[model samples]
Target: MSENELIERIKDRNPNEPEFLQAVEEVISSVSKVLKKHPEYHQLRILERMAEPERLISFRVNWLDDEGNVQVNRGFRVQMNSALGPYKGGLRFHPSVNQSILKFLAFEQIFKNALTGLPLGGGKGGSDFNPKGKSDNEIMRFCQAFMSELFRHIGHFTDVPAGDIGVGSREIGYMFGAYKKLQNDFTGVLTGKGPKWGGSAIRPEATGYGLVYFAENMLKSVDKEIKGKSCIVSGAGNVAQFTLEKLIQLGAKPVTVSDSGGFIYDEDGIDEEKLEHIKHIKNVSRGRISEYTEKYSNAEYTEVNSDDDFNPLWQTKAECVFPCATQNEINEKDAKHLTDNKIILLAEGANMPCTAEAIDVLQESKVLYSPGKASNAGGVGVSGLEMTQNRMGVYWTREEVDEKLKGIMKRIHDDCLETVETYELSDHNYMEAANIHGFLKVAEAMKAQGVV
Candidate 1:
């Protein structure tokens, strides 16, 4: 079928799912030329199956709050494409949970997992249940209720879920405990388990570290280097903190870190002592970014009031930018600022943090732009590694897992380069390159396995 025909078919099948359709259309546009090279896939009707997920599971999660009142939230798991291996992705637990967002994430995971060269398929499950302000018992009860149904559809060799957004180690523990009770087995059904359990040592830092590793490859392609470059990173959570740490170790100087409330700028760079304080406060104490400024007089924390500009911290000049925050954090205006400041590298640590308009602006200016699918695949890549260790019943040391993650990131970089060269595209547009590279792998697997 023609491109237009395929798109029309997709629209007819899922008329209201614009979010999922947008992602599918973008991937199709990037590799349409290559698909023309192989008419067999088209003859086999691959696009029909590729456009929709193989399975989508939705259910209700009911729990009792500390007030002895019943609370309910909707849950979902979109097992997109699993021809490569078992379905694997994170489970997010936030108020914003819905079919549109989960479909976008699960669609992205299909390519991200393939890029890791791990035998993991793509899937994502989460609930609209908000854990914030809930007591420990309340959160545990919600997780158990969510997993009671989810456990039936998942397994170690079938589907393995990690954590994302509001779903942290604590939530994973609750879900895993419930799964064990339902299945009556102690299996590695999830990847982001605590170290005391079957979780890998490097899973926490993999995404952030992998991002810098991918960026390093982008730098090398242009005969540039990461050493001594200034970086402005958004988000102080797991992905941001680890990306900053890895960038510093690789000789990049990160000077800014932000949270939901505001960002803190440290001209002297964030030292270990300061990072420890930030982590202790954010992770352990659950305090706001303002506390960091209170303890350290030199650091400046800007209040991100609703009326304030979205990216108040972008006024500062920097050579590199890493937006590790939520979706659409970097707008078109912010893209212009980075370009005006002569930012050489802009790598996304969060999924689609750059709006389509912002991305177009960056592409027009010719700055090296690495999308999150490839740059932030490190977290899921490490989860795949954890699955491997679990299957083998052998846990690796932190250093060993980090080494493997570095290797995978290097390979992802090389794959992007190869795709760019093959298409005669510019090196800066690694987004298209990564998308095509990831797509072809899953496509080939689907072709080999036949339609499910």
Candidate 2:
């Protein structure tokens, strides 16, 4: 079947799964040229099989709250593909966790892992149990219960899960403890463990750091540098915090940072000291971005206005824009705002943070755009490094891990550029290059394995 036909079939099969279908359509459409060149992939129904998960494990997670009330939540693990190697991805724990979201993330993971040049395949698992507002004990109980059923399907050599969104060091610690107790063996079944417990030194910061590395490469391609570029970074979470750090390290003036509450615009730039304060506010105090204005009198904090069609966070005047927040945070209006403000570079630190219409606007404006799968693959790349370190039973120094990560990010950037030139695409379509190049690796592996 044709790519469009395959997408239509996917839509029909996955009703109400807009996220999943969107992901499949993006990849299928991006790699249409390669699919046409190699019709064997069509004959073997490669896209059809690739769109479907190998295993979809769903269960009810029951745990007691601090009030002694039994809370039940839906949990899911979508082992999307394992043709490259073992299944590897993060497990998110947010109220937004659903089959559609997980499937889309898993599908994106396939290409992301392939781009990393790692043996890891793609999979993602999570529960709809919001860790927010929950007591430590309650959160521990929930993680333990979530792992009770999840442990049966995951392992170091099978499916290695990490942390995402609401799942951080605390949550990973809880889940790792439960998995250890359940299996009665110590192994690297998880990647975001504490450093003393086998986690890599830079695992938490890899994604954000790698994003800056990718962005730097993009700027260099245009004969520009990040040193004096003004940047607006959304989301004050791990990705945003570290992205700011790296940007500052490169002498870039990152002027804004945001959370769900809204964004803070500091014209003086967010230096290392400001970033540290933000880390404490979000990671320790669990406070809102508005608290930033109290510390820095020059900064302005804007609250999220639901009636606004465009996110004010993206409207900030800047040369570089990094969307490190949740999916679809940047709508078409926001994209137009960024373009009107003369934004030169935009890269996603979060998965699919920009809507399709937003991406079109950026592309039409000739802005250098990098998709999350390639730009944010650093987190998973370091996770893959953590797996190697685990297998060797040794830890590398911080400098070593960071160096390796920089090399990987540079290689991925070059590969995407090469793919774009090879495909003769206009406007340096990194999204299409990333999708096609990433898909080719996995597709070859699947074909060699004889359609398993």
Candidate 3:
């Protein structure tokens, strides 16, 4: 079937899964050339199989709250593809967790892992249990309960899950403990463990750091440098905090960091000292970004106005923009705002943060845009390293991990560039180039292995 025909069928079958359909559409649209060149893929229904998950497991998670009340939530695991190697991805714990969101993330992970040149494949699991207002004990109980059923399907050589969004070291510790007891084994069935355990060095900072590395390479392609470039980074989470850190290390002036409350704009630039304060505020206190203004008098915090069509944070004038927040945070109006402000570079630190309309605006404006699959692959890349370390029963120093991560990000950036050049695409279509490159790798692997 043709690309459009397949997409229509997918939409018909998944009428309520907007996010999943959007993700599949983006990839299928970008790989038209590849599909035309490799008609065998059509004969074998490669795209059809790729769009469907190998397994979708859903269960009810019941745990006790601090009040001794039983709280029930839904959980899911979408083992999308494992053609490259084992199933690998993160477990997000948020109220927004759903099959559609997890499927979209898992589908994107397939290409992202392929781009990392890692043997890891793509899968994602999570629960709708919000950890926001839950007590530590309550969160622990929920994670333990979530993993009770999850442990049956995941393992070191099977599916290796990591942390995402609300699933941090604390959550991972709880889940790993539960998995260990349930399986009666100690293995790398999970990543993002506490450093003293099996976690790799720089795992928390990998995605954000890799984003900056990718952005630097994009700037270099245009004969420009990251130094002195003003940057606006959304999301004050792990990805945003470390992205700001690496940008500072590269001599860039990152002017903003944000959270769900809103964004904080520091015109004087967020230096190392400011970054430390942010880390302490978000990572330790779990406070809002507005608290940043209380600590720094020069900075101003703005609350997100839902009534408005565009986020005021994106209206900030800057040379670089990093959307490190959740998906679809940047809409059409925000994209136009960035283009009007002449933003030169954009690298996603979050998965699919830009809406389809936002992407179109950026592409039309000739902005250098890097998709999350390539730009944010660093976190998973390091997780893949953690898997290797667990199997070897050894650990690497921080320097070694960071150096290897840098090399991997550079290779991903160069590969995207080379693909765009080879396709003779107008301007630097990194988004399309990235999709095509990663897709080809997985498609070839699937073909070689024969239809499953």
| RMSD (Å) per prediction | 1.8, 0.9, 0.9
Candidate 1 lowest-lDDT run of ten: 306-315
- List, in order, the clash count of every candidate structure: 0, 0, 0
The Cα RMSD in angstroms, rounded to one decimal, for candidate 3 relative to the true structure is: 0.9
Question: What TM-score would you give candidate 3 relative to the actual structure?
Answer: 0.99
Q: Residue 404 in model 2: shift from native, Å?
A: 0.5
lDDT of 2 by residue, 1-452 (tens): 76777888999889999888878888988988897689999998888999999999999999999889989999999999999999999999999989999999999999999999989999998999888888899999999999999999998899999999999999999999999999998999999889999899899999999999999999999999999999999998899999999999999999999888788999999999999999999988889889999989999988998677878888799999999989889999999999999999999999999888899999999999999999999999999999999999999999999999999899999999999988887757999999999999999989999967
lDDT tens per residue, model 1, 1-452: 88888888887877777567766776777778667888877887776676678899999888888888988899999998898899999999888788877887888899999999999899988999887777789989999999989999999889999999888889989999999999999999988899888889978888899999888988988999999999999988889888888887887788898888888988888777778888888888777877888888888888777564447777668999999988778878878888889998899999878877788889988999988889999999999888888889999999899899989999998888888888877755788998888988988988888756
Better of 1 and 3 by TM-score: 3
Model 2 stretches with alpha carbons more than 4 Å out: none
* Global lDDT of model 3: 0.93
For model 3, state the Cα shift of residue 137 in Å: 0.8
In order, candidate lDDTs are: 0.86, 0.93, 0.93
Query: 1 or 2: which has the higher lDDT?
Result: 2
